[model samples]
Target: MSPAQPSAELLEAAQRPFPDAKAMPPSVYTSTAFLAREIETIFSKEWMCVGRSSSLAQPGDYLTYELAGQPVMVLRDQAGALRAFSNVCLHRMSTLIEGTGNKRAIVCPYHAWTYGLDGRLRGAPFMTATTGFCKDDYVLPSIRCEEWLGWIYITLDRERPSVSTTLAPVADMVSDYGMENYVECFRETHVWDTNWKVLAENFMESYHLPVCHADTVGGHSKLSEMECPPGLAAFNYHWITKEASLPIGNAHPSNTRLEGRWRKTTALLALYPSHLITLTPGYFWYLSLHPKGTGQVAMIFGGGLSPEFMADPRADEYVATLKTLLDDVNVEDRGCTEKVFRGLNAATARAGHLSYLERPIYDFMHYLADRTTGFDRSFALAAE
Candidate 1:
């Protein structure tokens, strides 16, 4: 069935209650069964962020990464179009690319078989003419790929919902913010020793800002002053702060750049299933989470803003400023999330429910639970 027709029962299930946010259950973060189910039902069918258009800026440029235990490659073809394919070779199931680089063609080191940028089998050095081998049947399998604001996303399930449908609300929001012209300045990755959900939960709420980020983000804006909007996916928290409020001496050295700007506000937007976009002055950054296992997650961060902003002479002066802000924020979060993950695994605490103040996070959990349980039912019932 179509994405627009998600079952009413599933929607209701998503809107149901869990425990409080502070007292979340251990199973949600540590259960192997839950993780496996998430991999199959959520990650496999979702539009997962893989890389950026800038990563494959030129034809023949390629980057390889894994999602849900499946090796995937993002590359630009000879025609300058972006494409994605399973990194596994059709011949013996060996991975095609070990890492990121530019290549004229993809050649499997296992047997020297080569494939073109378009995923068409190009050469088989060992095959004999009498083998009657046909290249048409041996092309590398392709995955569904789509791009928005220079970010690349891929899906393994061919029958899954379209990217446009899954991300319609997000597209509208970013467009309203004029993000299409945003240019990227930096991209970084952090691997945390925690369930992916832990990171997502932390992002969904601003309750910890005054305590955890007091030295960095706290100096710029007051947590109590931020505006929290209603609706789970429709609105996220936003805060505007003046640069003069930044603490130059006592604050984390990483965010020292905020000292110069007249004013800047960091607008945090959390899209369901692991997509986060943050808008700061002259730049925008995003983090996409990929679960490695029940206890680990890989966070890939990318930045973009109007290209014009990067070209401005004044923008150069703010380089150190932006670096410090992101560094402190990420480092602090990494430490806290790792600790939270350990706490969830401690076996003494029970699963927590969402508080009224954390309605957005509750909404996200509801959405996840609904999708996980209702998808199969909806599909089956529709078939009948």
Candidate 2:
């Protein structure tokens, strides 16, 4: 079947100049048609962040991810190479795995069909009873998978650019942060009761820090401290300079090259489609968002210390305190984003003017418009 396309009106809206922009129309988030189109045009084709490569530590270690309702898994084969496969058994299309763990071989829970970690079909009990049955032709279908800086990203589309090529701008800007060697020390996954785009937009801006995060990190947010740069090929970023608030804020010493408040500065980066990251000198945290439907989003939230911090004897203490602070902040942000989703659905909800402080939010909206409409309209903020 041919892939679906978004509505012409949506494409027209994307080309509107920034000064004329209001928040996107409600239908973009609440409509069934739009969701289906997005699944076809965006989710299936994008190089999406699933989790960290470190999550699979050994051969046969595996983790599952879903894109547009199709389940797929990432694993290390006997060759120690990372690979991705459809999580459904070829026999009856039953989901093959529920979660992450080490497996000697992948055995389907239902019909006992088995597959090698490399995705080749190994055996299928009783299948020989059927004429013309060929186990050799029944390998689990593979998805495109790649690892960049400890993160594992996968895509259903075979023709797109590699993840590194697509996101090289983000890599260039944060190259000083040493992400390649940074291991994930803490991770949490949850399904939030909000539209996926809402949480993604929430992550790209600090405009609400004072009101939404009043008691947590708000005090550190000064409008002057943020520098919102224009969007580039694969991503957009704004820099925030604030002293460390979590106990582990400085638990690890800063790189000698980054002196002064640059050590405390955090680069808030959003890779197009939906990967958001906070790159700080000492530690990093991220949110990878995916739509569960029009009304819910699955969030993979995680953090880890820089190598310097990980090497510190006091790393454990700092991590404990940092987690607590983030936990509180997350509670605050959840409340705020869920409210926004509810507001978007209301009769009173309407697009609003963009604030310079919310520049990253502006960039993100442009990105969504471009993807949905098949045009690149990412340029120029409304006059300052």
Candidate topping TM-score:
2
Alpha-carbon lDDT of model 1: 0.68
lDDT of 2 at 84: 96
lDDT of 2 by residue, 1-384 (tens): 112333554555555565565566666777778887788878989999988888888999998889877899999999999999999998899999877889989999998888999888999988778999998988888899999988999999999999988878777777767777776888888889999888888888888888899999888788787898767757888988777676455425545646666677788888878888887777788899889988899988888877887787887876777677778988998999899889988988776766777767666766776676656553434432
lDDT of each: 0.68, 0.80
Q: How accurate is candidate 2 locally (lDDT)?
A: 0.80
- Model 2 residue 198 CA deviation in Å: 0.6
User: Which residue segments of model 1 deviate by more than 4 Å?
Assistant: 1-23, 232-265, 351-356, 375-384
Residue-wise lDDT of candidate 1 within 204-284, one digit each (tens)? 777776667887775555555565554343234444444433232112233333343222555577766888776654566
Error of 2 at 87 (Å): 0.6
Question: Per-residue lDDT for 222 in model 2?
Answer: 89
Candidate 2 deviant stretches above 4 angstroms: 1-13, 378-384
* Consecutive 10-residue window with the lowest summed lDDT within model 2: 1-10
